[model samples]
Target: MDNFSFYDLQPKISNFPDEVLAGLSKQQKQIPPKFFYDEYGSKIFDQICELEEYYPTRTEFGILQQHSSDIADQIGENSLIIEYGSGSSQKICFLLDSLIKPWAYMPIDISREHMLSASKTIADKYPNLKVLGVYADYTTEMLLPEYAISSVQKKVIFFPGTTIGNLEPEEAIQLLKRSAMIVGSCGGMLIGFDMKKDPQILHASYNDSKGVTAAFNINLLTRINRELEASFDTNTFTHYAFFNPQKSRIEMHLISLVEQTVVISDRLFNFLEGESIHTENSYKFSVQEIENMSERTGFKLIRFWTDPKKHFYPG
Candidate 1:
C-alpha cells in the first residue's frame, strides 16, 4: 500500500448544478456525459461492458491479448503508464504483464471511490509497481502528478475502451494534443478505437436486450436526483439510444414519458412528452480518419492491431 497514492481533483459540488442548469437552458436540452460516472453510474457501466451486445470491450480485450507482446515491445521498458478514464482497471493488467519493468501506473478517473479501489487492487497485485490514483476529469485540463514527472523514465498513455470516441473529432484532437504534451516528445500513446460498423451492430451495442444498458443510461437521472436535489421522476423518463448515420455515432438520450417540470436547486426545467435530453455521443471512426486525427494531434501512427473481425483497433 505504501507504493500507492491517491489524489482528488474532482470538481466542487456546485459545478454539477451549474453545468446542468446551463445545459437544460439550451434549445436542445443536453447534459455532459461526465455526469454519468457517479459511484452508482460507474458500477452500472462496468456491467455494461459485460453485456453480450457490447462488443467493443471484449473485442478490444482480444486484440490486446493477441498483440500485447508486440505492443509492449513498442512501448519499451520501465515506462510510466497513464490511463485516462480508467474504469475497473481491467485492461491495464494485461499491458503491465507484458511490459518490461513498467515503472508506475497512474489511473485517472472522475469517480473517487472507484479509482481508489482499482488503484489499490493493482498495487496489491503488483507489489513492485507504483500505483497513483488521480481523481480528475481527464477530459479537462489537468496537472499531472509531480512524482510521475520526476520518477519515471518514459511515459505511455493507455487509453482503452474506445472512450475517445465520445468526443467530436476536434475535441479528440485537442485531447490527443494534451496527451502528447503530458508524455513529452519521447512518450507514446496506445489508444483504442471503435471502428465504423453496421448500423444494426452499433444500435444493438447501445440497446442491449437485458435492459442493463437502459439501467446504465437511466442512472444519470438517479444521480442528478440524489446529488442536485433534482426532482427527476425516473419512471417518467425512459432510456433511448440509436445510431445516427449522419453523425457516424450512437446518441444516448433520456425521453420524457409525459409532460413535466423538474426543479433542481430552485431552477425549473420543463419537458414535453417525448422531448429528450441528449446525454452522450459515441463517434465511430475509420482508419483514414484516425490517421488524419493522429497527424493533426502530433502523434505518428507507428502501429495498430485489430481484432479478427476488425470491430476494434488498438494502436
Candidate 2:
C-alpha cells in the first residue's frame, strides 16, 4: 500500500447522502457536479473527452506539449508538483519530462482506485521519481502532509482541465486562496481556465450530437440511484445544456420528461413535467478575468498558453 499512498475515502462518502439531500432540498433542485465522477461517470467522461465536439482535453493537451519547457522554466528544479486531479494523462508526463529534478509529485482525487492506479503507474514509469497519490475531495479545503512540498522547498500546484471554470467566481477565488496557503507565498500555480468564445461552440461542447455528454450528465442520476438508494427514473429525464452568453458560462440541467415523485433518504420529492435540476456550470473567462482572479486570490498571473482562437488556456 505504501507504493500507492492511498487515503481512506469513507469520510467523503459519509457526507454524500447529506450533500445530495441538501442540494435537492433547495427551490432550484441541484446536485454538485462533483457527484458526476463515480466509476461509470468517470469512464463516460473519458469517452466524452474523445468526442469531436469536446475540444478541451485535446486543446489543453496541446498547450501542455507546446509550453512544457516554458512552464517547467517557471517551476524550476527540486520542486514538488501538487496536482489537484488524477494525473494519469500525458499532461503530468510532459511536465515531469521537462522539469529538472522534481522532488515529488502528488496527485489528488476523490476516487481511491483512480488515485492509487495512477500513482502506481507513474511510480512504475519513473522508478526513481516519487509519486504520492492522495484520495480526497480537492474541492473542499485541504491540508496536505507537512512533508508534501514543505515550506523549505519550491512547490507548484498544477490544476489542469477546465475544472476551475466549473466553480462560481467567488468559490474559485476562495479555492485559489486555499491553494496559495498550501504552496505558501513563494509557490506558483499553473491552472486551466476556459475562455469566453462562440456560444455555438460552447453549446456543442457540452451537448454533443453523439450524446456522450448527455450520458455523462445523466450518469449523476444513475449514481444517485445506485449509491443513495434514490428512485430516479433516469430514462424520464433528458440532458439539457446551453450557453448563457451574459454569464459567459455553459449550464447543464436534467429536465424531467413528466411529472413524477422520487424518494431519497426516506424523503419524498416532487418534480413537474418541465422541472429541472441544475447540475453543473462551466464559466468561461477572459485573460483580464483570470488576472483579476489571481490578484484577488493573493497570487500573480505568470505565463499563459492558448490557441489562436482563445477557446481555452491551461498554464
Candidate 3:
C-alpha cells in the first residue's frame, strides 16, 4: 500500500456531541450538514445522487465528460487533485482518465471510514498515482501532508459536487480562504454549482417522488439518537423540502408531527407540533456569483462550463 495512506486530523466522532448540542440550542434549531456523513449517512447520500429526480450528479458528470480533457489541460501535468467532501469518488474518474499525469489524489472528508474506503478503491484503480486519504473537515483550517506538496507541479482543488452550496456565503469564503492555505500561492479550485433555474425543478429535486430523500434527511436524526444517546421518535418527524426562491436555495427540514421532548445525554430539548429542525441548504448560483466568490476568497475564476441543457456548471 505504498501508494496509499490515510491521515485522521480529528478523532472519531470527537466533536459530534458538542456540535449537536450547540446546533439544537439555537433559537431556530439547526444542524450543520457536515454531520450528515457518518458511515451510514454517507452511503444514504450516495443513493441520493442516483435518484432520477436528483439531477446535479449526472448533469455535472456530463459536463466533465464533455470537457475533461480541456479541464485537464488547465490542470496540466504532474498535478494534485484534492476533492472536498470526497463522496463515492465516482465523478472524479472522468477527469482522472483524461488528465496527463496526476501526481497525487487527496480525498478530504469528515467521515474517516468513507474517505479511507473511497481512497483505497481509487488507489487500486490508479496504481501509479499516489492516494492520500485525509480524514478532516475541509471547512476547518489545515494543510496537506508536509511531504505531499514538495513534488507536485500544480495543486488544484477538485470540488465537483456543488457541496459549497451547503455553506452560507461568509462560511464559504472562510472555507475557500482555508483551501487557499493548502493549495499555496498559485493553486486553484475547480468547483461545481447549480445555477438559478426553475424553482419548481429545484423543488422537485429535493422533494423526490421516491422516499429516498426522506430517508436521507431522517438519517441525521438517527445518527444523533444513536451516537449521542438521544431519544428521538423518528416516526413522529416528517421530511420537508422546498425551494426558497428569495434566497435561491433549497432548504430541507425535519418537521415534528407531535409535540415532544427528546433527551440527549440528560439534556432536554422540547419541540412543538409542526416545529422544524433545519437540516440542510443547497444554494444555486449564477456564473457571476461564483466569480464573485472567487474574487472574495482571493482565487481567480479562470473558466466555467456547462452541460448542453445548461442545468449545471463547473468552474
Candidate 4:
C-alpha cells in the first residue's frame, strides 16, 4: 500500500487559537472542544478506554464485531471509507476485514502525530489499499481536500468512538450536515453513540479508579499553562463528571477549590470560589433520541446493532 494523498496536512490559518480566543471574547465564557485531543490528551483518553468502568468502547466494538459482515454488505464494495477522529485506527481492521475491497481510506484527526503513526500502520497492514491521512480540526471551518470535495460519487463516512458526544445538539447536526455535503446523499454515514445510563455509571467512566480520566481532564489545564503561558493550579482543581438526566449527557469539568487569580501573557483572570471551567460533554442518547436525531439530520437509520448488556442502545 502506498501513502494516499491528503487534502491539507496543515490546518487553515484562521483555525488558530488566537483567532478562536478573539472570537470567543464576544461570548460570556467559551472553550472549543478541539483542544481536548492534543497528544497528551489523546494518550490519557486511550487510558480512559482501558478502564473497567468505561463501557462505551467495549460495547460498541462488540456490536461491530458481531455485525461487521452485515454492515459491510450494507455499505457495499469499492466504497471509500472516511473516518473522523481516527485515533490509533484500532477499529478499522474489523471493518476492513469485512469490506475486503474498499477504494480508499481517509483518516482525519487533529493529533497529527497519532494520525500519521496510525495511518502508516494501517497502510502497512492493509496492502492494496489507498490510505490518506488528514490532520485537520473538523470543528473549525476549513476547506476539505479537493479530491474528496470534488468527487461526484458519495463515500461512506465513519465516525466511531462515540466522539459525537462532544458536540452540542446543534453543533452535532451542523457537523452531520457538513459530512453529508462532503459524502453527498449517495454516500451514507455510520456512527457510534453512547447510550444514556445511570448517573453513577456515567460519572465513574470519567472518574475511574485508575484516575486516568481525571488526569486527562486536568491535562487540559496543564496544556494551557505550558502553551498559552497561563497559570493554572492543577492541585487546586478536581475533576468532576456526572450524567445530567434532563440533558441526556455526561458533563465534565474542573472545579476550583478556592478563589484564585491566574496570570496569562501579563493579564490576570479571576475565578470565584467554587467556580468551574466546563471542559467537555459526552451526550448519551436513547435509541429513540438517536432515531429522532437521525431523522432531523436527514439521515435514515439503515441498521443499528448493540450489546444490550453493556446498555448499548443503537438506532
**Runs in model 2 lying further than 4 Å from the true structure:** 1-11, 87-89
> Tens digits of per-residue lDDT for model 4 on 100-196?
5788889998777778889989988887888888889776665667775565365888888777888899999888777766777888898888877
Candidate 1 on 1-315: residue-level lDDT in tens?
Answer: 699988887544438878988999998899998788777886888899899999998998888888989999999988999999897899988888898988889999876777788899999999999898899888788887787877776999999987899987788889999998898888989999999999999988899999998998898888888888899999999999999888899999999999999999898899999999999999998999889988898888999899878899989
Provide TM-scores for the models. 0.92, 0.92, 0.92, 0.89
Candidates 3 and 4, the one with greater TM-score? 3
Which candidate wins on TM-score?
A: 2
**For all candidates, what are the clash counts?**
0, 0, 0, 0
Native-to-model Cα distance after best TM-score fit, residue 163 in candidate 2, in Å: 0.8
- lDDT agreement with native, every candidate: 0.89, 0.84, 0.87, 0.77
Q: Could you give candidate 3's per-residue lDDT for residues 222-303 as a string of tens digits?
A: 9999988899999999999988878888999999999999999999999999999999999999888888888888888888
| RMSD for each of the candidates | 2.1, 2.2, 2.0, 2.7
Candidate closer to the true structure by lDDT (higher is better), 1 or 2: 1
- Model 1 ranges with Cα > 4 A deviation: 6-14
Steric clash pairs (candidate 4): none
Which window of 10 residues has the lowest lDDT sum in candidate 1? 8-17
Q: Give the TM-score of candidate 4.
A: 0.89
Can you give the lDDT of residue 185 in candidate 2? 76
Looking at model 2, the pairs that clash are: none
Which regions of candidate 3 fall more than 4 Å away from where they truly are? 8-14
How many clashes (backbone atoms < 3 Å, residues ≥3 apart in a chain or on different chains) does model 3 have? 0
